[model samples]
Target: MSRGAWRDRGAWLLAFMHAFVAVCVLLPSAGVHAAETVHAQIAATSEQVAALTAVLEARLEPLVLEVTAVEAVDPAAALSAPPTEDVARVWITLDDGGATAIVLSGDGARGMVRQLPREGASDEVLREELALVIGTAVDTLRRDAASLASSAALREELGLSPEPEPPPEPAPSVEPPPPAPPEPSPIASLPPLPPVVRTPPPVEPTRWRLAGMAFYEVQGFAAGQIIAHGPGLSLGLGGPPLTLGPRFELSGQYRLPAAAENDVAGLRLHSGAFRLTTQLTVVRSSRVLLRVLGGAGLDLLVIEPFLVDARAELMPRRVRIAPALRFGLDVPVRLAGEVSLRIGAGMDVDAIGTRYVIQDGDALVPLLDPLRIRPLLSLGVDTTFVGHPAFGP
Candidate 1:
C-alpha cells in the first residue's frame, strides 16, 4: 500500500478503538457524573436563594404589619407587649413600582394608606411609609372620637354590616352537691418539675478559602517526531462570590524533547518548549473538579533531518505555538495552619515544529509540509498561600 494509504488506515483503526471504548464504557460513567453534578449545583443554588429570601421576608414582616390596618387598631402599644387574645386578620398588597394606596379592613376597622420607595434608599423607607399610613388613622381615631363614630356611621349608611358578636354563657343550676375532701399535701403532690435545661447557641461556619497546584509532564510524538519531559505550575482562586467554589487559575510549564532515528526510514531530532496556561473551574467538590482551560505560549524546536547516505540535514532554532488540555483531581493537605496543597494529572497537546529538507538527490530538496503533534501526560501540585479559608467545622 502507498504510504499515505497506510497512515490513513492506522489513524482510522486508532480512532475506532478509542470510540468503542469511550461509548461502551466511559460515556455511561460520564453521563452519571454529569447528572450528579447538575443536581449538586441546583441544590446549592436553592439553598442560597432560600436563606436570602428568608432574611428579606423576616425584615419585611414588621413593615408590612405597620402599614396595614392591624397596627392602626393599636399602634401605641410596645412591640414586646403580649398579643391580644382577640386576633384581627389583615391582608395588604403593593404594586410592583412600590408606589400605590392600600385598603385594609378587619375587626370592624378599615383604613387606607399611600406607600413610596425613595431612590438610592433601602427598604427602611418602606417601613417608614408603613408607619405613616397606619399612624394617620390612629391619630384620627384618638384625636376625635366623633370622627371615628362618624366613619362607623358612614359604613352603616353604605350598607356595610357590623361583625357578629359571640354567644353568651348560660346560668348555673341551683341545689348543688357537697364538695369532695382535699386529697394530697404539697409534699405528696406531683414530683418536682425537672430543672429547665438550656442549650448553647449554634456556631456559624467559616466561609473563606484559597487553593494552589503544581504538576510534572512527559510527552512523546508519533514516529519521526520528538519526545519531551518537564514540570508545570498552577495557581487558583476561590470564595463566596464564586458560589463558595474554586474557579480562576493561572499555570506555566517547560518541556525538553529527546531526539531519535530509524535505520530504514530517516533521522529525527527533538526540541524544547515553554507554555503558559489558564483555566476556569466550572464545578468543584472536596476532591474533584470539572474544568475548562486554554492558553497559548512559545515553543522552541531544533531540527535534524535524515539523508539517503549517512549524512543528515540540520537547521537552526525556530519559534512555534503551544496549547494544552487538563482534567484531574486537586487533593488538599492541611499540614500548616489554614494552608493546603493540591495534586493532579492531565493531558496536553502542542505543536513541536516544521519539516523542510529531505534526502532526494545530490542536494537536499525542500519539503513544504511541516506540521507536527505531540501527546503528553502530566502531574501537578499546589499550595494555598494567599487564598481565603474554606468553610469547615
Candidate 2:
C-alpha cells in the first residue's frame, strides 16, 4: 500500500536471507570442530581409574579429550592397528615391586613407557606424574604428525617432485688386459706339513649360589581367649638358585617367651622351630625377587604356669612337640650389591593341639588351650655368595 511500507518489507527480507546463509556456512565447520575430540582409552586398577582420568584431563589442556575406562589396554594390539588422529590408549600396571604406565599413540607407529615409583609418594602425586608423562607423549606424537602433514603440504605447494635416481653409472667397461709373466717356484719342495689337531677346552658346569638370611619376625597365636604375640629371630641357609625348578632352604627360628595372664592364672610360653622349605620364584628382576614358599616344620613349645595364690605351688614347666605345615610368600628388594631387604608373610597349622590344665582343688581347670593356627610376619636381609667349582682333573 504505501512506499515506506514496501521499502521496509524488502530490507527485512534481505536481512533474513543473509542471516540464513551465514548460519548454513557456520554449522558444518562447528560440527567438524566438535567431532575432532581425542578419544583416550585408559586401563587401570579400579582404585586408580578416577584419579588418573581426572589428572589426564587437567594435563592435556586445550585439546578436547574424551576418556573411557576399560578393563584392559594392550599396547601391542593398539600398535598393530592403523593409527588415527583421534584415538589413544593408556595402561597402568602395578605390582609389589613397582608401577609402570604404557601409552600408545593413535598412530600405531609410536608408543611410550614410563616407570613410576611405588613408594613414598601420595596417590595424587603419582597420578599427576603419570598424567604428565602421558600428556608429553601424546603431544610429541601429535606434533610429529602435524610437522609431517605440513611438510607434505609445503612440498605439494612448491610443486616439487622426488629426485630421479641417477641412471646407475653405466658399469665401467671391464677392459681385457694383457697376461703377465709367471714367477719361479720355490727350490726343493718341502715334505707335506702334518695335519694339525685341535682340542676344545673342557666346559664348566653352572656354579651354585649360597644364600644366608637373618630375619626378625613377629608371631601371633591364639591362646585361650586372648591372642599371644612374640618376637622371634631366624637364621636361614638357602641352596643354589635353580633355573627350572624350585630352590631349597633350611631355617631355624627361636621365639622369645611371651605371657598371657588371666584372672585365675597366668601362663608363659615360648617355642623353637626348624623348617625346610622349597621356594619357587615367581617374579625375578633386577630390582626385586618374589617367591612362593611352602614347607613343614617341627616346633618345640615350652610352657610355664603360675597360680595367683602365694601359697599355691608353682606348676612344673611342660614341653610339647608339634609338627606344623606352613605356606608363605616373600619378596626381596635389592638394596645393594649381593644384599637385599626381605619381607615375608606366612601361616602355620599345627597338627596337634596341646591343652594345658591346672589342678584347682581336684577339679582340673584349663589354663591355656592349644593354638591350632599361627600367623607370622618377617623382615630381614639376605646375602648371596656364589660358590666356585670344586677342584678336579
lDDT agreement with native, every candidate: 0.45, 0.68
Candidate 2 C-alpha lDDT tens digits along 1-393:
999999999999999999999999999766644544456666666667777677777887666667677776554444344556564555565434355665555654445666787687777777777777878877776666343233223324335553344587787888789777876668548787899998899865455656778887766676435444443444444433434236677877777776765556778887877788888777767777788999998988888887776766687888888898889998888887777888999888877775777677889887766577778888888776554211111
> Against the true structure, candidate 2 has what lDDT?
0.68
Q: Give residue 92's error in model 2 in angstroms.
A: 99
RMSD of each: 50.6, 42.9
Each prediction's TM-score versus the true structure = 0.34, 0.43
With a 3 Å backbone cut-off (N, CA, C), the pairs that clash in candidate 2 are: none
Please give the lDDT score at residue 306 for candidate 2: 72
Over the stretch 115-164, how does candidate 1's per-residue lDDT look in tens digits? Answer: 45545555445445643554454444334433433324434543455434
The TM-score that candidate 1 achieves is 0.34
